[model samples]
Target: MAYTIDRHPGPDAPRLGAMVLHPIAESVPRARRWFQKFIAPYNPACSVDDCALMISELVTNAIVYGRSDDPWVVRVEWFREGASLRVEVHNPGFPASVRVRRPDANDAHGRGLLLVDSIADSWHSGPSPFGGTVVSFVMADAWPS
Candidate 1:
């Protein structure tokens, strides 16, 4: 999907960075990369790899469940707020109805939200200003590592 990457810098820290891409499988990896670089400066406090994994899951969900036959876009953005790191994924679809559920022992799928729940300090979903579902998650600025 055609896309654009825009990075905004703040004197104290990275302000807001965003990417808009067509909802597709490849967008998942791209999202992860953008997220990693966006948070690179703060990796001393944040877990970049964990954040990237969450990005992958959210982007995958958007591509797999949030799109239709009509062309639409998925957006990713991240920024720092005090001692918190916030990430959001917005896609073209109805508001997300996300919930955490137990996965079967042998199940290979259906664990996206669960992973988010366990990893993120807090998370939620709602309608996006850009005309679709938005799922946002936040993690503490300082991780155990």
Candidate 2:
């Protein structure tokens, strides 16, 4: 598992921040803080709390479901788009499925995507260009007064 946060911003990825994290439970909060700070200056309207919660869910899923044999590297990224903020979480292993389905209340697992679906303005999961799954979500930008 690698522990590196690379900073690279570009026209294509305006206000972008990316990091490669070990697929561990602690990586979830680390990603949340990094993403919150990354989008703060650019997307002032972003709800830091919402970003925190959603980021946690995404990274948690990656850590819990990613490949175990290989060092599972989770890539987290965010960028400003038009009037929205986009966040993507990538993991090294693909899941059997990444669809949102309601789990029974008694069920202690499988609520990550459901949480993301309710919080994010829009989101989708699919094969990443690099190999594995990429879960992404967009939220409407709210500028501060």
Candidate 3:
């Protein structure tokens, strides 16, 4: 399935921060920290710990599944839409490759997207305008009144 890459936050949504990370295992922690710090100023109502965990999982997936020899980079962007927070992880991968897997108890892998589904208020995966896959999630009412 071909997805329009223009799916992004609108004018009303303010961008918080964006980072282009190397497609490496080490980038996961960095992405989490960056997300945590950027959203800290907003005092989101959502749990920062849960957000961080989701970011970590997404970044790890990008590094593992989205890796390619040509463009070895992953982009992570965050935006604030009123009380909601939106995050996107972009990589040179296929949208079909991203799915919520049903992992067994013994499996060490295949649990990333499941965590995202359970923790995030909403999430989606599609092609990025920049020529790759983009997996995004939204935490509604993230900001406090």
Candidate 4:
């Protein structure tokens, strides 16, 4: 229910780049570009578009709930192991444990993670020692050179 939000260093990256996206509305466009460029060289299946959407939804969550004064962070890193691409969207904190439910007719909010859940081939959320929760998604693809 109550989760802390903080930035803690994560696993060693073996890919293009890892960025810390500030939890600000103005930062979304720049954040999407970061993901596009990262997958430009490899061009994996359903990768570029999917990754962008993933970033948008995850970062949007950080911006929405991280509270303007709370200083939220979106830590994103990509790595390929065997036959999968692992994309982790690290949030400073996790809200109360709530299942992803379809919104009612008048609902406009609460669909961010819903998008993440539907689009991402696989995803999960867990506690972060850094003080929050990191929601991760993985798309299966061959290793790139």
Please tell me which predicted candidate would have the highest TM-score against the true structure: 3
Q: Please give the lDDT score at residue 134 for candidate 1.
A: 91
Per-prediction CA RMSD (Å): 3.4, 2.7, 5.5, 5.9
> Compared with the true structure, what per-residue lDDT tens digits does model 4 show for residues 73-93?
666666665567777666666
Which regions in candidate 4 have their CA more than 4 angstroms from the true location?
Answer: 1-15, 67-72, 95-98, 142-145
Model-by-model lDDT, in order? 0.77, 0.78, 0.84, 0.66
State which candidate, 3 or 4, has the greater TM-score: 3
Tens digits of per-residue lDDT for model 2, 1-145: 3343555566665646777888778788888877777666664576778877988998998887777476658898877776777888888667456778789989998888898898889998888876888999988764432
After superposing all C-alphas onto the true structure, candidate 4 shows an RMSD in angstroms of: 5.9
TM-score for candidate 1: 0.83
> After aligning candidate 4 to the native by TM-score, how far in Å is the CA of 4 from where it should be?
24
Candidate 2 backbone collisions, by pair: 45-142
Q: Can you give the TM-score per candidate against the true fold?
A: 0.83, 0.85, 0.88, 0.77
Global CA lDDT computed for model 2:
0.78
Scored by lDDT, the top model is 3
Ranking according to TM-score, highest score first: 3, 2, 1, 4
